[model samples]
Target: MKEWWRGAVVYQIYPRSFLDTSGDGTGDLPGIIQKLDYIANLGVDAVWLSPFFPSPMRDFGYDVANYCDVDPLFGSLEDFDALVSQAHALSLKIIIDQVYSHTSDQHEWFMTSKMSHDNEKSDWYVWADPQPDGTPPNNWQSVFGGPAWTWDNRRRQYYLHNFLSSQPDLNLHNEDVQDALLNVARFWLDRGVDGFRLDALNFGMHDETLRNNPPRQHFETEPTRPFDFQEHAYNLSHPELPVFLERLRSLLDQYQNERFTVAEIVGPEPLQEMKDYTKGSNRLSAGYSFDYLYADDLSADLVRNVSADWSDAGDSGWPAWAFSNHDAPRVNSRWGGENADAETAKLFAMLSLALRGTVFLYQGEELGLPQAEIPFDRLQDPEAIENWPETLGRDGARSPMPWTENDHYAGFSTVDPWLPIDMRHYALAVDLQQRDEKSVLSFVRDLIAFRKSSDALKTGSLVFLDTPDDVLAFTRGTDEGQVFCIFNLGRTQANLDLPLCTQTEIKFSNRSAKTSVLPETIPAMTGYWL
Candidate 1:
C-alpha cells in the first residue's frame, strides 16, 4: 500500500539467466525463489522480473501468448504465487513485466483475429488490407530488419509488428483490447503483484490513418527506417494512449496501493516522450528512457543535462533511472578502460542512488561486472542473430550471476548454463566478496544504507556543482540540509576549481582514485559524498 517506488532501487532480474534450478540451461521461478535472498541482500526496494508469461520464446519471452499465466518454461501459477510470497517475505516488492504492446502470433486473440476480416476478434490487432500490389499495408519496417507488416493468408490482410513477424502489435485503439489489457493487470493485481513494467508502452498506439513516415534527411547519421526515420508524431505517443494510461491508473488505484507502471520508450527523443507519458497525475507514475543505457560516455555535463531535463517534472510524475538493462551492453563495456574498474562501478552505483529518482540496477551491475565477452558461436539473443559484429546483443550482458568461485557455472546452476560462465567474474562473486571491506558489493550495501538514512539523497532536490569535466559534482538537498556528491568520471588525476563547496564531509567513496580540486587533492577514480 505504500508508494515507495519514488527514489526506490529496483533490481532487474532476467528470469532466464539469473539461475537455472531446472538444469535445462534456463532459469525459472524455482531458481528465482532460491535467489530471493541474493536480491534482498542487494538492498534494492523491489525486483522487476522480466516477462515470464506464456510466451513462444521466439523473442525470449517478449512475445507473450498469454498475459495471465506463467509459461511452462518458467513454471505454473502456483510457482509464481510462491515466488511472489518469497519476494514479499524478503521485504521486496515484485514488479512483473507487462508486454501489452504486442503478443505472440500464437495468442488466441491473434489467432481468432486472423481467421476472418469481420470476425468478432477482428481489430484486436493492428491489421490492414494489402495494397493493390499485394505488398505490406504500409512502408513501416520491422525493428528486426524487415517489413513490420506480415501478411496473414487466412484473413488476406497484413498485421503490424514493431518487432518480429511472429509478434503482432495489438491495436490499443480498440476498446476491447484496452479492456483486455486492464483485465490482465487486474489478474496480476488480484494475485498481489506490486506493479507492471510496461514494455514499449509508447508503441501501444499507432496512427489510425496509416500514414507513411517521412524520409531521413541526415545521411551522415545512421540509416533510418519506418521505425527510427520519422518524428513518429502520429504513429506513436498518440493522444489516445494517455487516456488508456489514465484508465490503467484508475484500475491500479482500486487496489489499496496504486500499482506503478514504468514505460520503456527508446528513441532519440525519449526525454520529451518520458515527460509526456508521465505528465499528468492521471497517467503513469514514472517513465524511464534509454538515455543512460545507450550512452557510450558518462561525462559530468551529460549527468547535469539529465538532472536539469526533469528538474520540474512535478509530483504527478517522476523519472526512473537505469544505466543498464537486458537491451543494453553493461556500462562497464560501454564506458571501458581503467574507469570500468570495480571502484568506478561502485561510484556509479552510489551516484545513481544519490540522484533524486528511482534507480534500476541490472543483475551483475552491483558487482561491477562488465559485458561478458561472449563468442560468436555461444550467442543466444535474436538481436545478435540479426546483427552480430556491430552489436553484442543482450546475451552479452546477461551471463549468469556469479555466486561463488571454484565452482562450475559460477554457482549459478548445477548444470551447463545457457551462456558460458565468465571465469573472470569468479573473483567478484558474492561468496568471495561479501566478507571484503573494499568490495563493490559492500559499497552498494553501505550506499543503500546511507540512502535509507538520508532525506537529502532520498526525496530531495539535486543541484549540479560547477565542477569541471571528468569530475562530477552535485549537491542533493532537502529542507534538512545538503549532501555533496562528487565522482571522478575519468582516469587521469584532473584538478578542478571548486566554487562554494570547499568544506565537505566524506560520506562515502567508491574508489581511492586520486583527484585535485584547487587546494586539496582527492584520490584517483574515487567518488565522494558529503
Candidate 2:
C-alpha cells in the first residue's frame, strides 16, 4: 500500500462550529458537505473531522455514546455518507475522530457493564473494589479535574475515568472489548472513511495492576490539576498500547485502500512515547504530541530541539506536527502574544510545513484567526471551566468560523451558534481575506500549493543549521532536490550571513530577500524558502 500520509496536509474541522445547515445553533454533516469545495480549495490532502458521534456533551463529542452511529445533533449516518461522497468527489480524504479509551456513561455497553458484578459485560469497563478507607484504588487523577475513580452505587465499586466521571474507561485487557473496538473501526472503513485520528491512544490501555503513579520527577512549574502532580506513567502511555495498535493495523489491512491512523499522545515526556506509537508498519501511521500546542513562544531552540528528536526516528516512524487545535489556544495568541500579526502567522505556516512530517492544520488557522475572548459564562469546555482564572481555556480557539463579515453569526448560521462567535473576527472573515491580495488565508493556500508541489518540503529529511537565537534555519533534502527554510522568529530585525551559493534561487518568501547574503538583515516575523 502507498503511504499517502507521508507528508500529507490534514485540515481539522470542529463540526459544531464549522457550519450550521440545520439551523439548530449547531454544525452538522450536511453543513460539512456544503463546504467541501472550500476545504478542497485550501489544498489540504484530507479533512479530519472532530467527533460527531452520539455524545451527551460531557467532553464535547469525545464521550461517545454509540460507536457506529451519528448523533442526531450532527445529522444521521446518511448525512455522513453524503459528506464522504462530496469530499471524495473533491479528491479529499476524510479522517474521522475515534475515541476508544472511554465511552459515555449512557452508552449501552457501559449501561450494561455498570449494572452488576455478574453482568455479561461486567468486565468491559475498569471497575475495582475501594480501599479499606473507601478511597480510590490508586493515586491516579482525571484529566479534567478531581479523582480518576468514581464510585458506582450499583456495583458498590469504583469505575475508572481518565476524564469526566461520565466517561468510564474501557478494559482493553479483555479480548472481547478489543474485538468490539476493532469492529467499530471496520464499520467506519466500510462506510468510506479514509483514515482515523485516534484520540488519546495512549489511554486506551491502563496499568491493569492499578499502580499509583509516582510523584513527578521535576516540578518547578505550578501544577494546574492533580493530573499534573504525578508522572502519569502508570495510568497512561501503558506498555501494551503498541500491541493494541498492531491489532488496529491488522484490521485496517483488510481494506483495499491505503488507510492511515494517527494517534494523539499527551504526556510529560511525549517524544519517546510518540516514537513508540509510530515505530513500525504494525503501529500508527503517525503520532503527534502537545509539543507546540501550549507553547508560549516560538524560539529557534524550541524548533531545533523538537526537530532533532524526530530527525532520526527511522523510515517507518513518521511524525505529525500541529501548532494549533480545537483543544488549545490559537497559536496567534500563544506565540504571537500582543503583537499577533499576519507576518507571524505566515512565518508559522512556513516553518510547520517545512518540517519533516505530516501536517495537521486546525480550522481558522488559515485565516490568521486570533484567540476569541470568550467570557467565563460562555465557556463550554470542561477543562477550561475547571481551570478558568488560571488558564484561558480552549473555547477561545473553538469559536465559530467566520465566513462572512456581516452575515448572521458570521455566515456560520442563520440563528445563534452553540458557542458565541467572536465579533472581532469579522475583519478576518474568509470572504474578506479572499479579496485581499496579501491576506493570511491567501498565504496559507500558497504555502499548501508549494508544499504539495515540492518533494523536499513534502517528504524530505530535515537538517538544522546553527544560527542566532532569533533565527531558525533548516534544510529539507530529498532525492529530487533540496531547499533552505529560514525564519526570523525574533521581534526585531537580525542580520545573517547566508551559507548558500550566489546562484541559489529564492523559491518562496513571505518577504523579498537576497538569495546570497553577505550581511542581509532578516525582517522580524518573516520567512524565506530558497
Candidate 3:
C-alpha cells in the first residue's frame, strides 16, 4: 500500500468554527460535508478534524467523556460515517483527533475510578495520596495553571491533571488502560477513519515515582504560568509512551488497509521527543512539534536550522509541519507583523509546501486570515480567559471561518457564532476570494496543484544551498528530477548568483512574471521553484 501521508497536505478543520448546518450556532459534521467539495478542490490529500467526541466542553472537545461516540453538539455517529464516505468519494482521507492523555472528569472511567480505592476501574487513573503537608504530590504544574494534582475527596487521594482540573490524566502504564484506548482506536477504524492526530501524546504517561520537576536554570522571557517555571521532566514525555505507541501501531496494522498516526509532541525537549516517538515503524508514522507555530519570527536562518534538525533524523523518521493551528496565533499576524499582506501569505504557503514532509494547513489559512482581535469579554477559550490581558489567547486563531462576505455572521451560522467572526475576515471570505484570481486562496490552490504534480517536492530529500542572510535557497531532488527552491524571507530585496542552464525553467513562482532566466535580485517575500 502507498504511504499516502508522506508529503500529503492535510487540511485541519476546527469543527466548532467550520460551518453550521443545524442552526444551533455551532459548526457540525453536516456543515463539513457541505464544504467537502471546497476542501477537495484545494488539492489537499486529507482533512484532519479536531475532536468531536462526547465532552463536557470544559476544555472544548479535548476533554473527552466517551472516546467511541461523537458529541451531539457536532452530530451523530451516522453523521460522521456520512462525512467519511463523502470524503473518501472525493479522494480525501479522514484523520480525526484522538486525546488519549487525559479524559474529562465526567468520563465514566474516571467516575468509576473515583468512587472508591479498590473498584475494578479504580487504578485506571493517576491517583496518589497527598503529602504530609496536605499539598499536591509533587511540584508539577498544569499547563492551564495551578497545580497538576487535584484533590479528590471521594478516594481521599489527589488525581493527576496535566491540563485543566476537569481533565484527569489516564494511567497509561496500566495494561488494561492501554488496551481500552486501543479498543477506542479500533472502534474508529471500523467506522472507516483513515488516521488519527494524537493530541498531546507525549503526556500520555508520567513518572510513576511522582518526583518533583526541577526548576529551569534560565528564563527565555518572563514566565507566563507556573508550568513554565520548571523543566517538564517528570510530568510528561515518559519513556513508557513509546511502548504504548507500539501497541497502537500493532492495532492499526490489524486492518487490511494502511492506517496512519501523527503525534502532537510538545514539552521541554520537543524536537528530540518528536524524533524519538517517530523513530521506528512500531510507533507513530509522524510527529510534529510547536517549533514554528509559536515562533515570533520567520527568517531563513530559522527555517534552515529547523529543516536541518529534521534532515539529520534520516529515513527512519518522518516529520510534520504546521505554521498555524487552533492553539497558536495566526502566522500572518505572528510572523508578518502589523503590515502583513497578500505577498507575505503566499511566501509562507510556498515555503511550507516546498518543505519535505507532510503539511497540516489550518482552516482559513489559505485565505491568509489574520488573527482575530478578540476582546476579553467575548473570549471563550479557557486558556485565554485565564491568562487574559497577558496573552491574546487561542480564541483569536479559532474564530468562525468566513464563507460569505455579505452575511452578518459570515455564513458560519444563522444567528451569532459561538466565537465572534473577525469583521476584517469578511473582506477575505471564501466567496469573495473565489471570484478573484489574484487572491491568496487562488494562489494556494495553484501552489498545491504544482506540489501534487512534483514527486521531487513530495518525497524527495532536501538540501540547503549557501546564500546571503534573509535569502533561503534549497533543492529537493529525487531519481526523477531536481527542483531548486529559493525565497527572499525579508523586507528588502536580496541579491544572489544562481547557476542556471538553458534547460532550467520556472516550475512555480509567487512572482507574476514566469521566466526561464533567474533574476539577480529578488524582492522581499518572493519565492520560486525552478
Candidate 4:
C-alpha cells in the first residue's frame, strides 16, 4: 500500500460553516458535496470533515449518539454515500473525525448501562461508587468546569466525564468496549473513509485506582478551569493508551487499502506523548497537538524547538502540523496581530507548507480570515460561554465561510446561519479573491502548487539554519536536490547575510527580493523559498 499521507496537504472542513445547501439554517453533507470542486481546485490531497453524526449539540458532534449513521441535521446514509463517491471522483481522500473517548448520554450503550447494574452493557462506560461521604471518586475536574464525575440516579453511581456531563467517558479497560469501538471503525472503513482524526485519544482510558491528580507548580496566572490546576497525572493519559493504539493500527491493517489514523493528543507535555503514540509501525500514522494552535506569537525559537523535537522522534514517528483549526483563533489574528494583512497571510502559508510533515489547512485560512467578533448573545460554544471574556471562544473561528460579498449572509446560505457571518469576512470573500490576481487565495494556490512540484519541499528532511533572532530559516533537502526556506517572523524589517548555493531557484516568495544572490534585507513578515 502507498503511504499517500506522508507530507500530504489535508484540507479541514467544519461542515456547519462550509456551505448550506439545505435551507434549515445549518450546513449539511449535500452542502459539502456542492463545494467538492472548490476544495479540489485548492490542490489539497484530501478533505477531513468534522463530525456529522447524530449529536445533541451540547459539545456539538463530539458527543456521538450513533456510531454508524449520519445525523438528520446533516443528511442521511445515502447522502454520505453520495459524498464519498463525489469526493473520490475529484481524487480527494475523505478523512472523518472519530470521537472515541466519549459518547452522548443518549447512546444506546450508555442507556443500557444506566438502566441497572446487572444490565448486559453495564461495564461499557466508566462508572464508580461514591466515597464514604458520597463525594465524587476523586479530585478530577472536567475540561469544561466543575467535577469530572456526575451522579446518576438510576445507576446510583457517579459516571466519569472528562468533558461535559452529557458526554460520558467509555471504559476502555474493558476488552468488550475495545471490540465495539473497533467494529465502529470497520463500519466506516467499509463505507470508504480513508482515515480518521482520533479526537482526544489520550482521554479514552483512566487510572483504575481513581487516584487524585497531583498539583502543578505555578507558571502562569489563574487557569480558566480547575482542570489546569494540576498536572493531570492520574485522571488521564494512562499507560494503557499505547496498547489501544496498537490494536487500532492492527485493525486498519485488516483492510487492503492503505488506511491512515492521526490522533489528536493534548496534555501538559504533548511532544513526548506524540512520539510514544507513533513509535512504531504498529501504532498511529501521525499525531498533532495544540502547539501552534494556541500560541500567542510565531517566533524563530518556537519553530526550532518543535522541529528539533520531531527530528529526535525516531525513525517510525511522524508528525502532522496545523496552525489553525475549528477550536482555536485564526492565525492572522493570533500571530498577524493588528497589522496583519495579505503579506503576512502569504508568508504563513509558505511557512506551514514548508514544514517537515503532513499539513492541515483549515477552512477560511486560505483567505487570510481573522477571528470574528461574536457578541455574547451570539455565542453557541459551551466552553466559550462558560469562560467568556477570559478566553477568546472558538465560535469566532467556526463562523460561516464567506463565499461572495453581494449575496445574503455572504453566500453561505439563503437564510440565517447557526452562527452569524463576520462582517469583515465579506471583503475577503472567495468570489472577490478569485478575480484578484494578488489575493491571499491566489497566493495560497500558487504556494501549494510550488510545494507539490518540488521534491525538496514535499518529502524532504529539514535542518534548522543558524539565522538572526527574528528570522526562521531551514534547509529542506534530499540527495537529488535542496532548497532554503526563510521567514522574517517579526514586525520590523530584518537584514542578514543568508547562506547561498548554486542552482538557487526562487520557487516561491511573498514581498521578497528575487535574486540568485542572497538579499541583504527581507521585509517584515515576508518569506522566501530558494
Candidate 5:
C-alpha cells in the first residue's frame, strides 16, 4: 500500500458552504459531487469533508446525532456513495470528518444514558454526581464558554461537554464505548472512504480522577473565555489517549488499501500533544494543531520557530499544516491585515505548500477570499453568538463559496445560503479568477503542480537557513536533489547575501518578487524556489 498522504495536499470542503444543489439553502453531498472536477483540477490529492451526519444544528454538524448515516439535510446514503464513486473516478481520495470525542444530545446512546442512572447505556457518556452544593464535578470549562458540565434532570447528575451543552463527551475509558466507536469507523471504511480527519481528538478522554485544573499563568493576551483560564491538566489530554490511537491505527492497518488518519489536536499544550499522538507508525498518520490557524501575525521567526519543533527524525510523526479552517478566521485577514491583496494570498499559499508535511487548503482559499463580515443578526455559530463582540466568530470564515460573479446567489444556491455570501468574495469568484492567468487561483494551481514535481518539497528533510529577521529561508533536500526556498515576509524589499551554489537556477518565483543582478535582494510579499 502506498502512503499517499505523506506531504500530500488535502482540500477541505465544508459541505454547508461548498455548493448547494438541493435548493434548500444548504450545500449537500450532491453539491460536492458537482464540484469534484473543479477540486481535482486544483491538483489536490484528497478532499476532507466536514461532518455531514444527522445533526440537530445546535453546533451545526459537529453535534452529530448519528455516526453511520448521512443527514437528510445533506443527502441520503445513496448520494454519499455516488459522491465516493465520482471522487474515486477522478483520482481524488475522500477523507471525512470523524467526531469521535462527542455526540449530539439527540444520539440514541445519550438519550438512553440520560434516561436513568443504571440503564444499559448509562456508562456510555461522561456523567458525574454533583457536589453537595449542586456544583459541577470540577473546574473544567467548555471551549465555547461557561462550565464544561451541564445538569441533567432526568439522570440527576451532570454530564461533561467540552463543547456545547448539546454535545456530550463520550466516556472513552469504557471498553464497551471504545468497541462501539471502532465499529463506527469500520462502517465508514466499508463505505469505500479513504481516511478520516479526527475532530477535537484531544477532548476524547478526560482524567478519571476528576482533579481541579491549575490556574494559567498571565500572558499579554487576555483570555476570551473561561476555557483559557487554566492549565487544562486534568480536563482533557489524558495519558491514555495514545493507547486508543494505537487501537485506531491497528484497525486501519487491517485494510488492503492504505488507510490514513490525521487528528486535530487543540489544547493548551498542542505541540507536545501533536508529537505524542503521532510519534510512531502505530498511531495516527499525521496530526495538526492551531499553530498557524489562530496566529495573530505571520513572520519569518514565527515560521522558523514552529517548523523547528517537528524534527526530521524517523520515529517522529508527520505534521499537517493549515492556515485557515471552518473554526478559525481566514489567513489573509489574520496574517495579512485589512487590505491584504492577491500577492499576499499567493505568498501564503506558497509558504504552506512549501512546508515539510501534509497541507490542508480550505474552501475558497484558492480564490483569495477574505473573512466575511457576518452581522450579529445573521450569526448562526453558537460560539460566535456566545462570545459576540469579543471574537469575530467562525461564521465569517464559513460564508458560502462564490462560483460566479454575476449569478443571483454567487452560484452557491438559488436561495440565500444558510450563511450569507460575502459580497467581496464575488469579485474574487472562481469564474472570474479562472479566466485571469495571474490570479491567486491560477497561482495556487501552478504552485501545487510545482510542488508535485519537486522531490525536495514533497518528502525532503527541512533545514532552516540563517538569515535576517524579516526574511525566511530554508532548504528542503535529499541525496537526489535539493531546493532552496526564500520568502520576504516584510513589506519592504530585503537585501541579503544568500548561501547558494553558483550553478543554482530559479525554479519558481512569485509575480512581485525579483532577483537582482547579484541575486542578493527579494521583493516584499514574494517567494522564490531555487
Candidate 6:
C-alpha cells in the first residue's frame, strides 16, 4: 500500500521476451537485472514480472513445478536474488506472478496426489470420480480447449484444469493446500518480494460436487479456441473465491513491509467479484479484468462503462488497468490490426494511462511497438498453433524486446532468438527511440513523471466527459482540481465543437499541437488532457 502501485505506474516484463543474456535465446533473471537501469529510467514505480519459477513451460512458466526456485532456463536462485536486489537498489519495487491456482502435472504434489486417493497430498488438487459411463466428471471445457476434466489412469479419477490439462487446478477447499500455498508465498515475501500478481485467483475454488456447467446462451467466439462458447459460471468465478483471497491477504499482511497482492480475476460477473475481493482492506489490494486487452477499439463508452461500474462498486475497491500484456496481443495490432499507425499506438498508451486507476505498461508498449509476426515454423506459443489465422494468439506478443537494430538478433541474444525478431520491431529499438525526442518512449516517460508530480491525476477521481465516435474524453481530478482529457481514436480527423469548460488548460497532448489553437478539426489519432 505504501510503494504507490495503487494509482501508480507499473511496468510488466515478460522474462522470455524482455532481454536475453544466456545466448540460449530466452531472457532470464540476470538479463532482467542488467536491464533494470533501462526499466528504472522509464520512471515506473514498480515492475511486474511474469512467472519465472521452475516449470516444464507448458504455458511459459505459468505451469510451475516448483514455487521456491528459479528454473534452470531462467537461471539459478542466486540470479533471482540478484535481480531482486538490483531492482530494489534502483528503488523500483518488484511484483512477481504467483500461479498458486495450479501447477504442472509433473509437480511432485500432483504426481503423488494422482498416484493414489489416500496420499498426503491427495487433496491438493481438484479430483472427482468418473460417472457410471466412465466419462469425465463434468462437461466443463478448458480455457485451452476440450474437457476441463482430465482423466488420470493412476487414480481412476479426473482432475480439474481451468486452463490446460497440464495445469491441474488446486483444491482451495482443503485447508492443507491453502496453508501450503500461503507458505510458498511467504517464502518469497521473506526473500524481499514487494508483492504478487496473483494468477487466476478465482480459479482456486471449484464446484465441489463436480456439477456440469449449463450450456451457454452464447459461447463468445474468438480466433483462439472452440472453448469460448459457454458462460463459464460453474467452472470459474465461484462465490467462495473471496474467502481464499481474504486468507491470502491475511498472510501478506504479516510481512514486514507493506506487501500488496493484486489478483488477475477475469470471467463473467468480474465487476461484482472484483469489488467483493478487494472492497475490504483484509482482502486483495486490487484486481483487473480482460476488458481492455480483449477489445479491438478503445471507445468513449467502453472507457466510461468500466470506470462507472467500478465507481458504483464502491471506493475502497481500487482498480488497475492495462491495454496489453504477455497473454494478449500488442494493442497496436488490436487497434489497427495489420496496418497500425505508430501515431495511434502512442495515443492509445496515453489514453490508458489517463484512466481512473494505476496503469500497467507492458514492455515495448512505450516504444509504440506493434505485435511481432511469428512465422508458422517458429511459433513458440501453443495457443497460437492450436488456433491459428483467426487468433494470432499471445506468441506474437512475447517476442524478444528489440534493444538495437544492427545485431543479427536485434541485440536480444547471441544465439538464434527463442522467437525471431520481427524486422518491424528492429527499427523501433530502444536505442533509436531514446535519441528521438518526439518518440513514444520519451512521451511515456514524460507522461509518467507528470502523473506522479500531479496529485489529481495520480490519485484522482474520474468523471466521464461525453464525446462522439472515435473519440474518448474524461476528467481526472481530486480535491485540488481537475484536468479534462480527450482523444481521437481514428486515423482521420474528428471534427467537433469543444465542450465549454472554464477552468481547463491543455494539460497534456499526445500530439505536438496545443488544444487552444482551435483547429476546426482534431487531427488523426490525436488527444489532449486539459
The lDDT values for all models are: 0.82, 0.88, 0.91, 0.89, 0.89, 0.82
Q: Which wins on TM-score, candidate 1 or candidate 2?
A: 2
**Model 1: ten consecutive residues of lowest lDDT:** 513-522
Q: For candidate 5, write residues 256-300 as lDDT tens digits.
A: 778879998877788888888888678888877578997889999
Q: Stretches of candidate 5 above 4 Å error?
A: 499-503, 512-518
Candidate 1 structure quality by residue, lDDT tens digits, 411-452: 888888888877778888988788897888888888887887
Clashes of 5: 0
Residue pairs with backbone overlap in model 1: 513-523, 513-524, 513-525, 514-523, 514-524, 515-522
Instruction: Please name the candidate that would achieve the greatest lDDT relative to the true structure.
Output: 3
Q: Which residue pairs in candidate 4 collide?
A: none
Checking candidate 6 for backbone clashes, the offending pairs are: 219-229
Lowest-sum lDDT 10-residue window in model 3: 499-508
Model 5: lDDT equals 0.89
Error in Å for residue 310 of model 2: 1.1
lDDT of 4 by residue, 1-530 (tens): 44888888999999989988889778899999998999999999999999999989788899999989999999999999999999999999999999999999999999999999988899999899999999999999999999999999998999999999999999999999999999999899999999999999889999999999989897577777888898888777888889988999998998876887998988876778888998878999997757789788899999998777777335748889999999999999999888788888888899999998889999999999999989999999999999988999999999999999998899999999999988899999999999998899998998888788777877788998778899998899888888798888887889877547324666677774557545677777888888
Q: Give candidate 6's error at residue 349 in angstroms.
A: 1.5
Point out where model 3 deviates above 4 Å. 312-316, 501-503, 514-516
What's the TM-score of every candidate structure? 0.95, 0.97, 0.98, 0.98, 0.97, 0.95
Window of ten residues with lowest summed lDDT in model 4: 498-507
- Model 2: residues >4 Å from true position, as ranges? 312-316, 499-503, 512-519
Residue 516 lDDT in candidate 6? 55
Can you write out model 3's per-residue Cα lDDT over 433-473, one digit (the tens) per residue?
99999999999999999888888999888998889999999
What's the candidate order when arranged by decreasing lDDT? Answer: 3, 5, 4, 2, 6, 1
RMSD of 2: 1.6
Error of 3 at 342 (Å): 1.2
